[model samples]
Target: MTGKIRGISILALLSALAAPPALAQSAAPSTAQPAAPQAADASQLEEIIVTAQRRQQNLQDVPLAVSSLGASDLQDRQIRDTIDLIQHIPNLIGNNNVGLGSSNTYYIRGIGNTESIATQDVPVGTYVDDVYISRQNANNFGLFDVERIEVLRGPQGTLFGRNTTGGAINVIMKKPSATAGGYLEAGAGRFGETDIRASMDAPLSDKVLTKVSMYRNRSDGYVRQVNTGDKLNGSDNYGVRGAVRLLPTDRVTIDLAGDYVDENEANLINRVDPATGDRIATIGITQGALAKYFTGTKANNEVGNSTKSWSLSSNAAWELDDLTLNSITGYRQTTQRYFIDSNPAAPNPIATGVSPILNYSLHQQWSQEFKANGQALDNRLNYTVGFYYLHENNWTDLGTGVGTASGFTVSGDRTIKNTLDSYAHYAQGDYK
Candidate 1:
């Protein structure tokens, strides 16, 4: 064991590690204190807790630049999706392209993808709880039942790994609590939009608790199809999430979560902006067919999309005397298809064989993470060390058939598949 190149001993650096100046926090006790807790007053400012670094801390205490939206902020602002969030946050923008609603493009600090292609990975990293979502297309998520959303600006190589080169976002869902309570909600909006949501939390016993939440949203598409003269672009979506908490012991906690989203809507098409009353200019398309791009135009604008996604995750934490160990495992999959009429106009005898298509894609991802976080030297030092592994597989179907109004049919079809596997080990410490 001794026949090796002489190396510096890690022990020699012990004196170099300085501890930060902060009060050490004691782990949560098993039994509640006999004294009743004081109620917080709404009129007074409250403390905001965040897990941006894989550990809970006051938002103001974190060293990095961060922005956060809480559940109340989301509801009061009517932010149902990340797209909606773009309006409130600075230096953020959402792609104006017709998107199916699940994974839309977003720009943070001018870093993001302009195209909606599922294969491209955007620079902004997104995480659900502690699980990292690698691909940009998978970052678009519904904002229902979310506890908080934290946007961390700048590179995060230590905790989040490569995908956070631009930045990172963490979406935290409300987990099951040791309580028996529930609520129901419903709302209506313009454009035939209606939403219904319900959630219930109950205790299975003293050691186990569970919670389930679901919502259904429906709205009329604003555009009109040429063939059926039916409403074209609109909203139709629904999603549900469920969670369970196992507290077998005071020091050990386990959380299991599963959720699914189904989105069905017409493919995004060129249309006149309602507010501006201006017809959208077509690119690479003839001027004569420009009128067909209007939302209510009679050209056969037959297009639609069906997007489905689901995810499962487990988080286990063991609280020790001065530290916490966490294990997070996750699996996610998505399937989406975009259907469009190659010829939205009347089929001409000359171009009878042409067909138009956007793209169909399938993706699956799985990851595992282990983290150790805690205080050292009587709360003077804060540190986090973790390992992460991620694997992804994606498949896409491409259709090619270019025909003028003369009716050109598709001449070729192609398929592509990609697989990726990567892992990382990282550690960081803050000593005051």
Candidate 2:
């Protein structure tokens, strides 16, 4: 739903947090089938492989209720980011309610986290290339050169461990291709929106392969400021990823990958009356105070959200006679800064009332996991066991200023820090 204010489209009046792109061979503008390999029989269905149980198996063979989107599925459906999965995955919901450009709040079966604080944990765990992402901030990443996306629809504590009480989401990136091939894509949308995406795959040798992918997008704000003729509720963000796959031998494989993302977005806008908590009038002489404030002119100090993050990971596997041994190690860091102009509608800048809120966060974490999977009893029994370790530290800084008729006050800035160290051994087995 949308409206217009003085010939300007009110694309987004609720908050500057406006939310929710395109393609390649799997993402071309054609109505082609998904990337899953089809069975030789014409009447047979395509075989969809999944790692929901920490092992590759036919999607239907897995007992859990799973939703899988292959590369072609994502491209055909235009599922450009993490948030877009909600539309296609049943009983799933996501949004950028955290107010950060690259942040997200996801709910699966009505269980999830809404706060962006560093101390709290998200019930719904998120993973990329088998590495866990502990923080929700900057988790809303742009999807490029993806292999598949899997959403597990129930408690996954057995295999995923803590924070999986709700469920889990897995993003499997496209590994370096054996053959040399890639694609480039560009797109445009309303409100001066534009984006570019590209990926390239190169094989250095018979045993070495490498690939890189990147994307960037920008759009004008939908909510227009009549005074300055500038729009609010806009975003500018970009990300890049590089991967290398080493096939030391037929029975051993190794993968090394790293990625970085940056985001800058407009600040949140007040669209409702603070006193009565009613919708502010955006039209005519009866315009509410907040609406009038939006139209009125003032000093332009566009204090918004700026976030930057990066990570590196390595994964290796060894295939034995009857068992598969795997190890994964990862390290990640993030920094975010944002501010809220509490109130500029006050009659007096220093006395009548105004409060400004500012926040800063710095976080980093590292984790390692070793696991083994195998089957016995004439292939009727399947099992997996793993040991995991993790360490993380976070720092948060907060500041605020208040104004009143009597006097003005500025609160001293404060910082909060938290650190965590965890270790556990888990095992799961299934028998027919």
What TM-score should be assigned to candidate 1?
A: 0.78
lDDT of 2: 0.78
Q: What is the lDDT of residue 259 in candidate 2?
A: 95
lDDT of 2 by residue, 1-432 (tens): 234463354445432344212223444467765568755888877899999999999998999989999999999999987988888999888877445557788889999888777889998889998889998877888899999999998899888879888899999999999999999999999888998999999999989999999999988766543233445567788999999999999999999999998877744543554565533212111112222222111112244567889999999999997799999999999988765455635433323444654567889999999999999899888999999998999987765556432444666456779999989899999999
Residue 205, candidate 1: alpha-carbon lDDT: 95
In candidate 1, residue 378 scores what lDDT?
A: 78
**TM-score per candidate:** 0.78, 0.79
lDDT tens readout by residue for model 1, 274-311: 56663321112222242232222212222566678899
User: Model 2: residues >4 Å from true position, as ranges?
Assistant: 1-43, 225-229, 270-302, 341-356, 400-412
Error of 2 at 432 (Å): 2.3
- Check candidate 2 and list the clashing pairs: none
lDDT on C-alpha atoms for all candidate structures: 0.72, 0.78
